[model samples]
Target chain A: MDIDTLSEKIVAGDRRALSRAITLIESSRADHRDQAAQLMERLKGAGRQAIRIGLSGTPGVGKSTFIESFGKMLTGQGLRVAVLAVDPSSARSGGSILGDKTRMEELSRDPNAFIRPSPSQSHLGGVARRTREAVAVCEAAGFDVVLIETVGVGQSETVVAEMSDLFILLIAPAGGDELQGVKRGIMEIADIILINKADGDLKPAATRTCSDYSGALRLLRKRPQDPQGFPKAMMVSALERDGLQKSWEEMTALTEWRKENGHFASRREAQARYWFEQEVRQGLLAKLDTPSAREAMQSFAAKVAEGGITPTVAAQELLQGLRD
Target chain B: MDIDTLSEKIVAGDRRALSRAITLIESSRADHRDQAAQLMERLKGAGRQAIRIGLSGTPGVGKSTFIESFGKMLTGQGLRVAVLAVDPSSARSGGSILGDKTRMEELSRDPNAFIRPSPSQSHLGGVARRTREAVAVCEAAGFDVVLIETVGVGQSETVVAEMSDLFILLIAPAGGDELQGVKRGIMEIADIILINKADGDLKPAATRTCSDYSGALRLLRKRPQDPQGFPKAMMVSALERDGLQKSWEEMTALTEWRKENGHFASRREAQARYWFEQEVRQGLLAKLDTPSAREAMQSFAAKVAEGGITPTVAAQELLQGLRD
Candidate 1:
């Protein structure tokens, strides 16, 4: 239970200890948090060796299948692979499918591969707190490659991008008009574009779709820093296992290039800084529940509704009320 | 400038007075807002007769063109139309394109049509405020139909649906995979699905896409609490004027049906209630900027970052600190 003992167990590659450590950190419990902090401090120098890659797509883009194929490929080459699949929690249940293990059964059964799925719980930050904590756990467990699979290319996926060394965006063969509707917010965040399900009768259409996307992508200005590559597009098929190796190779190449070029380290540092700021914002917002603050808010709102004043003015009045 | 005088002029079809009143309400200036409140009270019963329609799509869906064509159709039939197009504010400039009038030259020139583009400012609710106020202005100026075109159909579009009686979702003829990626959140909100750009070589593809969407849509359960005759789908072209009449007919049918069933009046009442609630939330959050709250927040955050506490615990500590 002590930090040093738990840290040793985790570093010795005990999966249970690693999982428990993540849970402790993720818990809102006071004592567990103290234990988690102590554990993270002891294991501070234990992580940071894994190649973290974030993969995202709209649902049904074969995200699970793609991870399975890519995991199998990595393990086949004698690389230790760990996957953290982040599923947004069901709004009704506040729980995830937690089906990544079943979806990646072969790799899950492999002694060299580990898979974990974390529920988002409606939090927009990419990778659940448990999942990010689990990545450090995985790294401490000596996994060389950590794959973070997130659902959709929205706020949740952007979280993955922040924590990842490489970010992959997956799409299908979309019609011209459909492609145009793709939000620039997501597109701007994407580092690599993969058009999945590019096999069978849809091959020609997929090819056309790829060309169309590639053409549109070209019109998008490059990242102010990158001179050569700006979200390179490729065609792949998770079912057919086609282009899986090629995509993996490209990912590895990008990681290596970024790491060597200083972008990787700097990117990780930036992510760490962002994580800190966001945590503070979330923390402060959660604190406005004091009795006087809450009381003043209620009275002010009642008055505003009674047509005594406007919202902006009422807000200022409430703040002054709090001060008194 | 008095409420009674302004109200009389607005009802007498004074366009400038209506525009100025809306601008005043949307203004943050304290005096302007007080005047706006007076204006709101006076005009409360004057602008409820217009048919409010919400149109949303991902960007590049030719939203402006569609609105222009739809406005033209209404004006051609001697019906007055007003459009409020919401444009995304560029983060860099903190300004919007506000180009709806430019894009809608034909409709703008028409005597019976009015077009206004509101900037999506720092506050999501602010954009919405301007929009609702603009709609009231149009209604007071005798426009029978008020069309609200959203900035885009991701998260922001949800606000538009809260104000409009009818919600129309525009999508392109998507192939199989992209179809799966469309958020079910969007589908659930859509009262009518309009497949835009169904023309030329895309005609057959569009028809096939329509069938696919129709089939997929059938799998969804009937929306609870929604009136019957919701979720109609049709193909349309803003450029070619294809299916424009059918789309308009559906809107009219829904409006008439809702009016007959008493849902129309209730919907407007619900919208006003919802707007007040949203304003309260924004107003209360603004109170969190008080110096005492800010200081307590910083100190608690330091504790969280130092690993002596968790965010939730830190939150409680801040609230407790406020009491001191």
Candidate 2:
């Protein structure tokens, strides 16, 4: 189908059309890239918006469980929910974190819910870019909520934060040293931290972990975008279906506050500009991937490794060659 | 002076010529850059090497005090020491972390020691590049040890780590939550963690912090370059000059083991290649700084922000323009 028909179908909340559009966005072929760009441009006229929540957690942090419960809750409340993931490791492992649709059986079967696994090709930057684009596609498809999930490791969290409206970090309850496992950079970007597994035997531990993180968050520099008592830690039990409603309420409250304070629109604008610069940087780096450029870089790298030429001098010569 | 004379003077331990060579390296002038490259090429034949130690800590962590005591100890042991700093904030504040020479009064007065402040202008990349070159000049000048210091925040630690053989992170003793302040990325790169200010009533707290960090480090994946009990934390009292000798011994022990295991030579080769790639990346980014390129980027960015064009499409157009 042409871009117009596909975009129209997507805006009408057709799941099959939305899936096809996302696949086009993930494809690296030249023709598909052109079509994807055209489709996105067409969809821009939809002017539909969703509450985009970025969620991240380490492996075994019960991310799938929480998403299943929370997504089901939204669908039951007459809201269409879409789930997308950005898995950096999928490029190497050929297995995505959300690859198993059975992991969220109930939500996957829900008519009002849409679930898509991560793309299992390309570098982290490309993966993130495609995921961000997929999010826009979901929003244009009349989804009331878009949940973008990523593993809590390396630079992935930062990339997810750039595309998200409110970033939530999920962590398993540990002993008194729970804060040690949290990265300082990740903590700085998180708008809310959820202590998962707050049911059964882990109840006391989760409460303690929640309080510890609350104190730690208090020590962080306050962001201008947040209202009072924001970016706080909360306890949640996805298994028991507890705290999901309260957490959703808090998310909507924060989103509404930001919308009233004018931070919501400005944040999206800044994120667009950030992604634009990132694309430019990636495009420039892609130039070095040609056979001749690779040969030149390898030869210069050998010289640098042997200490025969200073790194700066070798780089200058290589860049000069590119210019010529 | 000519490049030949400058290299010879630097090799022969002429401090003034060494200083002049570093100034040339730091200069942005075309002529000075050419001279600096030539001088570096000439000095490569000197074949002298020094232990390059990168130290980082937050401000008020007694970095100056620790360095003063450590430098005094090294100089007193008859080893010539050179101190260089990389301060990213200097570009904006016009003040450097190591700007005050009197901060290390005793070390500055020592005949066996050399102290230099951070370059007060340029971005972090340029500052790191010049500092790396200055390290080479110091090595040619027969310094037995070179200490590189940077603030313990942001990406500066990673930059300094790229140019140094050993990375040490210093922290002040805090009550039980010390690890919360440390960035996980920095912790992974650190070869050693030092708990400073272990004197007076804080001695007990320092020991507790050291133990806590030791447990945390043990949980991290073991690196192949390290031997048993490696990347461990230690307690030091820079105020009372306590643990200085023991820490020095540990550093030498680690260095000697790495040299024997062949990690020393390989690490430097890898660092040289890393720096070469960094320079190439920086050179590519510099193309975007031109007037016409700036205008193009702003126009594209504005379109992206206003939803007139997708970021990917705008970036592709901008890159195509560059190619044309």
Candidate 3:
């Protein structure tokens, strides 16, 4: 089938077409990239309805459990939902087994839900590019909400945050030890922080953890990219299935407020601009990978490694070759 | 003066020429950049003697206090010391006042010590460039120990780490609240973790924090760039002038071990490669800012911001213009 036909099928809410479109975006072949770009251009006129939410936390932070409960609650509201994981480890390990839908049996069984494992073959940058496009496909396929699940470690968190309207940073009770280890920029980018497992014997610890985060959040300088009401802390229990309802409501409310303030559209535009800059860099790099340029870079790299020459001088030489 | 004369003066251990050489590196003018590069080329075989160390922590971590005491001890051993800072906050705020020598009165007065505040004029990347050159200058000028002091916050920490032979992450005692908020990638990069302010009542808490960090360090995958026998934790009383000996001993031992195993040379080569890649990107951005290309980029940016086109498409258009 032609890409236009594929675009039409995806816009008409065809899950099979949506999945295929995502696969096209994930392909590294030159022809496939052109086709994917053309298909996106074709779908450009289509409106997006999904509330794109980025959900993240350190591994073993009950991410799968939270998504299971959260997806179920959203689907119960007569909403179609899609869950997409961004797993860099899967790429490294060549196995997308970690957050695959079999673990979320309840959500997997729901007719209104769709879950796709992360692409396990590419580097982090490529995975991010594919995940962002998959998000667009899900939004076009009539899903009311798309939850991008990414581990809160390293570069993955930043990538997921950029693709979402509201970012939810999830944690657990008595996690002060782990919290001390939270990456520097994660809290600043977080829209809402939820203390999970806030039930039974963990209740007091959860409340204390919430208070601690709240205090810490207060001290943070509000980052310009964060939704204004962000850095706020709340409590929830994925197992008890409590607080999931309020969490959904809050997520939607924040989205609505951002749209009303024009931040939603502007945020998307800014993201587009950022990716555009990145593309420019990548293109320049590709141009510099010609045989001669490669040899120059390699020679300079060795000289620099051996301390025979400075990197600045080598850069000057390779940059000259790019001009030639 | 000619670049060769300037290089000759710097190599002859002239402090005036050393400071001016640093200023030359920090210059943004294209001609000065060329001159500085040429001067570095001229000094390639002069050899380096200084043990370069990167020291970083949050603002309240008593960095200046620690450095002052540490500098005194080194100077007491008849070693000439040079302190160079990478202060992004100072850059943004238009003041290098924060880490200037006045904050370390004893070090400022030490006849054998040389201190230069961070260049208040450039972004972190530019500052880092100047700083790496400044380290070279200080080394040529016969400083036995060159300390690169940067705030423990943001990208500056990572940049400072790459340019040095060893990186020390410093913090105060009972800093769980602060630890929970450490910038990601930092703990993994640190060669040594020191809990300063270990004198008086803070001693026990310092020991506990040290143990906590040690346990955490044990869980981290040791980075290949780290010096062998590192990621070690220690306690220091910079104020009481105690524990300084052990800390210095460990740092020198790690440097010696790394040099013996050739990791030191390999790490510097990797850093050179990393910076070479960065310079390519910067050079490409500069090209994009040329008059015709700038106009195209602006038009595309406006279109992207107004939602007239997706950023990827806009990027494609602008990049096409660059190639043309």
Q: Output the number of the DockQ-best candidate.
A: 2
Best by TM-score: 2
The per-model lDDT (C-alpha) reads: 0.71, 0.90, 0.82
For candidate 1, the docking band is incorrect
User: Candidate 2: where are CA atoms >4 Å away?
Assistant: none
lDDT of 3 by residue, A111-177 (tens): 8898988987556767877788788788888899999998865788898988898899998887556
The TM-score between candidate 2 and the true structure equals 0.95
The sequence of per-residue lDDT tens digits that candidate 2 reaches over residues B196-312 is: 999999989998999999988998899978989999899998999999899998899999999999998999999999999999999898878789999999999999999999998
lDDT of 1 by residue, A1-324 (tens): 778888999898887876777667666666875676556556656744898888888777787888888789889999999888666654335665544588887988988888766744545542355566667668877888998877763467777876777888888776766574466666777777888889998677778887877776787877743436657788998879899899888777777777778777677655554555455455444434568776766676666544454444555565556456
Best by lDDT: 2
Ranking by lDDT: 2, 3, 1
Residue pairs in clash, model 3: A179-B180, A180-B179, A180-B180
Interface RMSD of each: 6.5, 1.2, 2.1
Using lDDT as the yardstick, the better of models 2 and 3 is 2
lDDT of 3 by residue, B1-324 (tens): 898888888888887888889888888889999999988777766886688899998878789999999999999999999999988887777888555878899999988899999887656777887888888888887899999998865688898988888899998898654456555578878889999989899998999898888877888887764665568889999889889999999988888888888888777778878877777667756767578876877778777666577655666777777777
lDDT of 2 at A120: 80
TM-score of the second chain of model 3 compared to its true counterpart: 0.92
